[model samples]
Target: MSENNTRVIVITSGKGGVGKTTTTANIGVALANMGEKVALIDADIGLRNLDLALGLENRIVYDIVDVVEGRAKLRQAMIKHKQSQNLALLPAAQTRDKSAVNPAQMRQLIEEIRAEGYTYIIIDCPAGIEQGFRNATAGATEAIVVTNPEMSSVRDADRIIGLLEAQDLRNPYLIVNRLRPKMVKSQDMLAVEDVQEVLGSNVKLLGIIPEDEVIITSTNKGEPASATEGSLAGQAYRNIARRLRGEEVPFLDLEERSGFFTRLKGLFGNKK
Candidate 1:
């Protein structure tokens, strides 16, 4: 396949526990559901968890390091999803550290996978700006900065955006995960606009995933929220997949569901 035919995207965050891995899993599954062949690479190395998130940990016989070090073929290390045949995972080697593979090797591995004809290659970058981050972004043609609706997360996301720009990955998209609408309405949390403002005008808002307990449950069950119905976070992820496919999808209305009078009072103010 031609290089233009495939999109290599790295999902990253400068801070940890911002739902970056979960976003990677759901986006991969969502794109696969849309009939696009997707390859997910867990680039965290020793601290790998994308396998567990995808529920394919037990099936991972070989990993990326195995492929990189010539111990296994690319296809041999790839673990195909049982439910979504279009989606496959190249898990990082838990026994190895980030030093096990370098940036050039990562680029080569991504190209090898690209030749396999996958439309989308999603790289789940390890948290922080370290060797792991460098390896993950080295092969990426695009980037998505995942963050939470908080001051620290936004600050870290801004730093990451700068790093991506420095690496020539311009116009990176943003996914504000774990946003609590009630908190936003109550002025306790930063709104999506606030995050965008902090990240600057260059970073575009890709999607907003409302805080949902279903995401935690789904991750624990080894099923991505995007694959399940009736999940707001899942719907948000699916929308992001659609957007990635060049479809214009409106952002989900994250306003808390409330009684008619309450909603009316929210829209209009309380009468003096």
Candidate 2:
């Protein structure tokens, strides 16, 4: 019942398709790569994709629902990652709904995992501000609110942050995902500073992930982008992981700098 040094982090988003599951998978892998013991829990219940993101879909036998129902032990339900010895995943039940597990059950499960001596546990929360979200965050010590660099995503993220604060979830950081620097320059998308302004002064901006095709390919291949060394999104996730570990890491510059041709054009008094 006593807690170890395990930090239970819930990765949530108020809206769907903002890369919450992907963020969770990568951060889990990044931490594991650093030699930290990590466990990823898919808290989405009926709709789960964290397993697929981690390439552990075929390894699932017992899920979180089974563990809560006393049908299986926690270790029996956990699937260890093939590539990382320190990384494991507790998949969600595809057939069960959010009501299948309550906050108390989730808290107890987290405690059991912590007692098992895991260093970090990342809970991949279901999208929307509903029962699934509540259940996902109940046992969390910290939170990572994932959002895209858009008006709707930012609005939902703000609402989610307020909800997290109401639940006494301290220091919930923000991750602006799927950002397009060219779009921002063309005045077609929201800038990072614009999002920061909308989220207000209290929220902390953790990191930003640029729109990269490599992420899409990685997801399709059931591999987390963070495990890929040359990926920009992977580098961003690794930086976020380092920041989460209390290390001072610089934010990734996703903006496209002016090239030689563009600067040459500007020198000719023709700025485009």
Candidate 3:
């Protein structure tokens, strides 16, 4: 391996609809924005969506399956992101099933990519405990567990964390997504503190992404929200990027409507 080989990291969510793919896409861009060479692999197989999230769906001539099957070289399968010169994507084969590739093959492919001099290689794992998930996490040096602040999401995250530990993939971090502080205050949602208590383990908080309509619009438009500076979700992903780079960043206060003291402090500061 070269001195600048890639570091493989997996972004996984134990349950569906927890913004795993979205996180993967944005983090790839965020890392690249920091001048680190980053690559994203969509290990979702038949349900591939990372390409669409990165807006590289139409440019994929080869996929991960083709590279493993000797039909295409790894470079041929990698599609560079349009906006980020340092970011790239290795899409999943829409024509292939999860069984077409195995964990060992996935590891081999990642190793090859690592030798090619990328700094960060992120794999977007398929949802659920199946062969696809195994293939996705085959060679993860580190992992990011994405979960919403809810019981079902937390339960699924626990299952995934258990599986990772069983496989000796320790110290995976957590990113609390779509957190609504007002809802949590009203007893309608789970707060980050509550989530940490239930998981029964210490996980470094990355960033908190709020439920934003702009995120949905960006996804529908096939553009990552991280591309926009005005987006709260985009800011959250950027903070995660900084955290990934070992920088200390403060978490965002998601709840609106400040306390009387806080409001008074803001008012006084404005007057000064």
Worst 10 residues of 3 by lDDT: 263-272
RMSD of 2: 5.9
lDDT of 2 at 59: 90
Model 3 per-residue lDDT tens digits across residues 15-105: 9999999999888888898888888999999989999888888899999999999999999889988889899899999978889889899
lDDT tens digits, residue span 123-165, model 1: 9999999888898899999999999988888889888988999
lDDT, candidates in the order shown: 0.90, 0.88, 0.85
Give the CA lDDT, 0 to 100, for residue 254 in model 1: 73
Quote the lDDT for 53 in model 3: 87
Model 2, 237-269: lDDT tens digits are 989988988989877656532355543443364
> How well does candidate 2 score on lDDT at residue 218?
93
- For model 2, the stretches where C-alpha displacement exceeds 4 angstroms are 1-3, 256-272
TM-score of 3: 0.92
The collision pairs in model 3 are: none
Report the Cα lDDT for candidate 3: 0.85
Name the 10 consecutive residues with the lowest summed lDDT in model 1.
263-272
lDDT measured at residue 100 in model 2 versus the true structure, 0 to 100 = 90
